[model samples]
Target: MSCLFSPIKLREETLANRIVMSPMCQYMAKEDGFATGWHLVHLASRAVGGVGLVLVEATAVEPRGRISDGDLGLWSDNHIKPLERIVKAVHDLGGKIGIQLAHAGRKSESRAGIPVAPSPIPFDEGYRTPHELSEGEIQEIQERFAEAAQRALRAGFDVIEVHAAHGYLISEFLSPAANKRTDRYGGSTENRARFLRETINAVRSVWPKERPLFVRISASDYTLDCMTLEETLRLLGCLKSEAVDVWDISSGGIVPTGLQPVAIGAYPGYQIPYASRIKRELGLITMAVGLISSPELAEYTLQAGNADLIALGRELLRNPYWPLSAASALGEEIPWPKPYERAK
Candidate 1:
């Protein structure tokens, strides 16, 4: 059997293969961040096409954390129905589904309503400077994450990923550059990591012990004052103690526009070394992401012991069948949908 097609047991959920469909925002949610028919069809088709794991996009733990007004949300019980449908559809097709629970931090852009964050930083020119969340409000937001996680449980999701990267709320708190307060939730690395740790603990408490808990973090700040590889290692080391099953390594996003680096400069698997380092250093399973599209590259990454799981973002977006096609291209027999057997 091809190693890529081998089963991976995360917590109690066993994935059929290592190819994970990274979450990409569709910005097509309804007014309440509820999944529309667009999400249902878009996510389900990938499972039908033969992805081992299809993770839904950055779902907000609160309305204010949405990257846009139309982003998917799990902030309320009402949000569960739409999500349950998506999860059921994916699983019914013999694939596992996970949800990326996120809070877009200072990156929150005004769309359906007012924007808010850990600081009043604006995502870009003309974007509203978000309302810096107060400490009490921060605690409340953690409660919201717990609530959303419970709703995810009700929605029948197999795994829950706390989205801490990509200039989001948790990311904001983690970045010393973004989090500029003298309070308990800011300043030192432990303090900066406090919010994310609390949020993770909150979600994990409600999330079934048998189910896996994943956290996506920027492996490097790619800028000064932002979290670095050393800090990330410390954070990942701490997170492992809290029972985080996988660390999805994707870099950048803490700094403001001028400091951010474009993806072009990084080589294929540019961030794999971070995943490898964390895995070796922290002794935890890690998922390598960022610009990994080809089957050979993905296999090479895994074979090199850089990551235990390979997450494909834009590649999967351009071709939802990338995994199945990759399996075929690599001489591995990936099962096709019964109806699409001849096509496969």
Candidate 2:
């Protein structure tokens, strides 16, 4: 069997394959931040397509933490039922599902609330000038993260990925480019990693020890004078004691000077090197994401020991059946869902 189709045992959860559906924001939630039918269909289809792990989009831990007003939320009990239904659908389809709990920080665009950040940095000229969170508020957000993680448990999610990448709240604190606080969460690498470690600790407190915990982080900010790969490694080294089971590695969402979309590297598996280095150095299971659309590349990445999992966003969106198609393309026989067997 190809490594891409090999099962990976993550704590008590064992994924059927190494192809993961990367968390791509669907901005289709209701204004109140409840999951809608769109999420159910989107996630269920991927499960049916045979993705071993379907990571739901970056779900906001609090209303003010949303990247957009329409982002999924886990702030209240009301949100749990809708998520439970989706989780049940994925489970019924024999696929493991996970959620990416996130806070957008200075990048939040919620009209109903003002965005807050580690420092008072704005993402860009068009973005709002965020309030610098007080120490008390910082701790509260961590509690919110823990509360959301508990909700994930209630909803029957197999995994919970802390969305610390893509210039979100936690990522802002991790990146020196955005975080300018003089407090313990800012100056040195150890200090900068404090908030993320605290947040992870908070989540781990409520999240079951038997279950797996994943942390998604930007390995590099893609700009000079910002957080480097070395800084990221150091930060993760400090938090290794948190018992984080996996690293979902991605890059570059904190550059505020002026982001050039075309300037960022876009080659297939461009981020694999970072994931490989992080996995080797930190001794943690690592997942690589970013432009890895081809099945050959995904399988090759795994075979090369560059990453433990291959996560794709646009590739899966373009074709939910990418996994089944990939199995065929790679000369592997992954069982197709009964309903789609004739088509397969």
Candidate number with greatest TM-score: 2
Residue range 136-176, candidate 1, lDDT tens digits: 99989899999999999999999888899877888888887
Could you report the Cα RMSD, in angstroms, for every candidate shown? 1.8, 1.5
Q: Candidate 2's residue-wise lDDT over 75-139, tens digit each? A: 99999999999999999999999999999999999986899998887899899999999999999
Candidate 2, lDDT over the whole model: 0.91
**Prediction-by-prediction clash tally:** 3, 0
lDDT of 1: 0.84
TM-score: model 1 vs. ground truth? 0.95
Whole-model Cα lDDT per candidate? 0.84, 0.91
Model 1 clash pairs?
A: 104-168, 105-168, 105-169
